[model samples]
Target: MQEKNFITVDGKRFHYMWLRDNCLCPECRDPNSFQKIYDISEAQSPPKPVSVVEEDDKLTITWQEQPIHQSVFPISWLMAHVNELDTPVQSSRKIILWNKTDLQKERTVRHDFHNCDFDVWVNQLFSLGFTILENIKSTQELESFICSMGPIYETYYGRFIAFIIAMRYTLFFPSSLFPLPSSLFPAPKSLLRSPCSEVPKNQRFVPHGYKTCYIPVKPIKGTEAVDLAYSAVGHPLSPHTDFTYLNLGRLLQFIYCEENNASGGESIVVDGYRVARDFRQNHP
Candidate 1:
């Protein structure tokens, strides 16, 4: 046994103890057992104190026992299990900004039945509040690029998705610097007339000829899935129940990508059921 250094999540320093005598994995405990408790004691032989290192939102503990021992856990875990520790401390940067409006928008957009590419649509709204890019070039090059898109990533409707012109630029830029030009993406006069000017001009852009549709889990390699495109940004998307409006039921996520001269934007998706299952379990 060795003296161990424990750093409370709130930055306080002290010794630590776990109120458990034996480490029990699920296999070691009865599956139906309601709960288990263990006793704690001071180390039999006090050696050098352990060191705690904080890195990238995680805390690592290292101690010099007869055999060196180390473990790492998220800083949030200490805050969550504060009561189990002898002393509780608060973290300096535990505060998170929950954009309620953004959450509401997420719920609404995911459920919207309209035929608009979800990523393009969300990016447009985020950019200008709302936009309508019109008179797009619909160039042969753009068409060729769309053709190059393989069926691996196509939407449920099997249409390739992208902006009208060939050039790739920022859609989320300030209105003052509209990325895509109207010469290539001209807005419809009717749609422009009704648009909320509150939206930044730069935010609006027309989608290529591709129509919006549901994004399936199946990889349409070389094809782009719009919804999966933006959701890949690593945000916590809420759990959605069945859809009442359309028999389409519920979707897991969406995916999309832009080709030609771009790198490092590969798609990633996590299983919702696995996330839910892990959230409900406590381990040894």
Candidate 2:
């Protein structure tokens, strides 16, 4: 069923003007910047869809506006933002909460890269800040897979893969093919350092021009406190988020486990968003 000036997708109603205003077409938005060039406020009247067609998980709308505007919206995108006009008090996106017991049932968070579809991959990444891609063989395959999602952001260290969404989060791939000697291996760099210089201007140990840091969890014997202070090696790190300044505070990270011979390096993932919601409910 359809309402006047609105189209229904999967039983949810979305206004024609809302859909048109949020159109992601290159003509309406800049491809690189992803900023909207066409202002919805400028329109004399609300957009009207002359024809609506749903096929292959896509909603195509042909607008009745002069010059015959047409736009295609992904069913996934529409479903994700179903409550866009809802009261501002509610959270924008619904999150799935899980504990150790939930994790035992089946692998819901991780997906095999070879078998995953584009829509499924996008949904998982969007809903969860992190997703583990299994069975990725080589760097070439990783590059190809990331490029399919969106444009690659090349940095001083390596290519940074970023997706276009509310936040522009970047993915970094560190190569293990060319293993360097312990003496020659570069130290972990600080994200605050300037991109122009190799060393920070303050004469700190922090290295610059590197977007990603490689931390080897393998056990190492006997190291000076000075060296250990500056390095991520042999150091136990508590759970933390990265680079809140960039990409709207939500960074999508992918951790591919190429090899796992060492012990005591188990990964832990906690749904911070879910925890916050629970806390608010209990307290208030």
Candidate 3:
């Protein structure tokens, strides 16, 4: 790697562009929101720092072109953002793709939620696509915990219903793993089905308060679901993701299972990405 026109924080080296773009000064970024106001595209050429100085836990930079433009960044911030670099980056987290063989051979032991690190727990979820956690006391506790990470979004399903959350697990597989905390959601009043619950015919399942799109349960005479879209006898929809119809490329479905009651409608898992790759390479 080129050493010139670069700043090294702790042991990691960052390029001139990285320094210019991450200027923490009020002129470049909003002090309250911390959102960047400085446009990196404003620089036609690579940014050249006239002087780079490290004092206390902060690194300050002065650019020759702007003269007034100075960037002060905490060393701690630099370390945390080491991933945003021009060179090859290494992360402790890894993504491992699995097939049915691993599903049968491997098992996940539930982690104690009260004593677990959220950062490490999330890393594990991404690493293997799913993890089961235990000891989350109640719906209020779970909602509070989830809200800490980000805001809660209510769509076709309202805020944290037991039924919709449960159905999301069985229908969406081979994506991000959302293992239900051992003590999850309120005891479900309805089934874990879209339309998973008792609803009027043709009005698919929408949570109690949500007014959303509905899928016609009854098939059109000429149009039939070929690749396994339904559970009606004889259709036998194949193992596929339900989100495809919604045009979703990737989504994380978190289902907190209090318990499984209904029998026979088991979730069938399929490695869609692997299947697509195999089909392309072998067939073509």
- TM-scores, all candidates, are 0.21, 0.41, 0.40
Worst 10 residues of 1 by lDDT: 173-182
Cα RMSDs of all predictions? 20.2, 18.8, 17.6
Model 1 misplaced regions, further than 4 Å: 1-8, 12-14, 18-42, 46-48, 84-284
1-284: candidate 2 lDDT, tens digit per residue: 46775677888988776789888886675454444556676788778778889999998888788888888888998998886543443445544565567556634666777887767666665655556777777445654665565544423224422111110121111221111000111222222235622432223332222233333222222132232212223343334443322333223344433432233335678777676577558644
The clash number for model 2 is 0
Show pairs that collide, candidate 2.
none
lDDT of 3 by residue, 1-284 (tens): 23576677777887787788778886775454344557776676668777788889988888867455788889898887786525644667775566767656654525787988777778767666667678766545656676676555444435554322123122211111122211113333334345544444443333332233444444321123222222222223234343333433234555554554323335455566566566558644
lDDT of each: 0.33, 0.50, 0.53
* Number of the predicted model whose lDDT against the real structure is largest: 3
Task: Give the per-residue lDDT of model 1 (tens digit) for 1-284.
Answer: 22233345665433444312222333212223312222222346433436767789976656456466555656665555554433543544332222344444542423232344646654644432333322233333333433343222223323323321111331221000011111112222222233322323223333323332222233212222233222222222232321222333222222222222323333222334344355346321
Clashes of each: 18, 0, 5
TM-score-best of 1 and 3: 3
Give the poorly placed runs of model 3, Cα more than 4 Å off. Answer: 1-92, 103-117, 134-137, 162-237, 245-250, 280-284
Q: In candidate 3, which residue pairs get closer than 3 Å at backbone N, Cα or C atoms, i.e. clash?
A: 129-177, 193-196, 195-205, 228-237, 228-238
Instruction: Return the lDDT, model 3, position 77.
Output: 85
